[model samples]
Target chain A: MNNNTSIIVTSEKLNLQTCYDFVKDPSCGGIALFVGTVRNHSYQKEVTLLNFSSYSSMAVKEMTKIAEQAIASFDIYKIAIHHATGDLQIGDIPVIIAVSSAHRGAAFKACEYAIDTLKETVPIWKKEHFIDGQVWVNTHP
Target chain B: MKIKVLFFGIFTDIFGKTTIELEVPSPINVVELKAFIIKNNPKSTALHFAVALGETYADDNARIHEQQVVALIPPVSGG
Candidate 1:
């Protein structure tokens, strides 16, 4: 079942280069990586930080499904997914997705598609810590 | 039948706790379930949530399977 895919749930930070390296197999000539960091501002609010939480089991399952879908839909060889849980300070790497393909075009397109679709379909949620107040944000809309 | 419904984000903050179970005569369909939630918390009308039955997100026409866990994930504004 473990066919060169890395999907994990952890509060610890993510290593983008390591994720990229795993997908850097010789069979895949092109690689694309996307990182989602916690911005310090949301709709003009001074966001102090963010806290991310997810039902780990369900989240990992959903992410695995997403990776599988991407591989099926696009011509890609390798994929890696890492998401941070618990409290995350501003500018923290909350989500990371990297895809490798035979060509640059497919890699770029597939990588972008994965992240967008992941935001829509994944069960993860984030709580924004603003200077004055804090609020939880949902995935859709 | 009584089914526990989980709410997250704005829905959770308003409802308090992450889950709420309600007694209904039969299996609750997605539309009806949404109406029930909105009725219980009128202010939640502004919240747009996606219902999930376990790992699979429910569609608008989905019907809740008996005793299945349902989750209401409010519209997420996260990046």
Candidate 2:
């Protein structure tokens, strides 16, 4: 079912090299990668850390769907989407998306689509912890 | 019938646990189950949640069976 897509959701750290390698293909001439890090600030708050969590099985399924959609919509060769859960400190890598295609245009487009779709569909959530308190992202208005 | 309802993201924080086993007197649909949950814990009504049967999203009128795995998915924020 999952052909050239690598979809992972875990509490362990996300590895950029792994995703890059998975999407690397001999025929593909271009590779695009995206890495998401825990920012130090949000909404004028001095964020201390971030806590990420997910319904792992659903998240993986959703990510796989995104990868498949990117490949189908674009001329991509292979794709990988990986995300991390649990406590994340400032600058910690939380997510990574890599795409490879015969040309740079398709690679870049597919990479962007993968990340954007993941944010919308994957069952992962982030809690931003500030020096004062903590709040879940996208939870409230 | 009894089913285990899983909570993800902020639902975990609001519910104070990851999963809960709830009993339904009869075969319940997704909408009914959601109402049953909300009637018990009204605070959950504050945030919208999507229902999933196993790993797939379900319609409100979808019938839920005993011993099935259900999940209440809140808004996602992954990138």
TM-score of each: 0.89, 0.93
* Minimal lDDT window, size 10, model 2 chain A: A132-141
Q: Fraction of native contacts in model 2?
A: 0.78
Most TM-score-accurate candidate: 2
Model 1 lDDT per residue over A63-124, tens place: 88878888888888888888888888888899888999988888888788878877886777
Looking at model 1, the pairs that clash are A138-B75, A138-B76, A139-B76, A140-B76
Task: Find the candidate with the highest lDDT and give its number.
Answer: 2
How do the residues B1-79 of candidate 1 rate in per-residue lDDT, one tens digit apiece? 7888777667667877887677755766888888777777746357577777776777888878767788887764433
Kindly report which residue pairs in candidate 2 clash with one another: none
TM-scores of the candidates, chain A only:
0.94, 0.96
Best by DockQ: 2
lDDT of 2: 0.87
Poorly placed runs, candidate 1 (over 4 Å)? A1-4, B42-45, B77-79
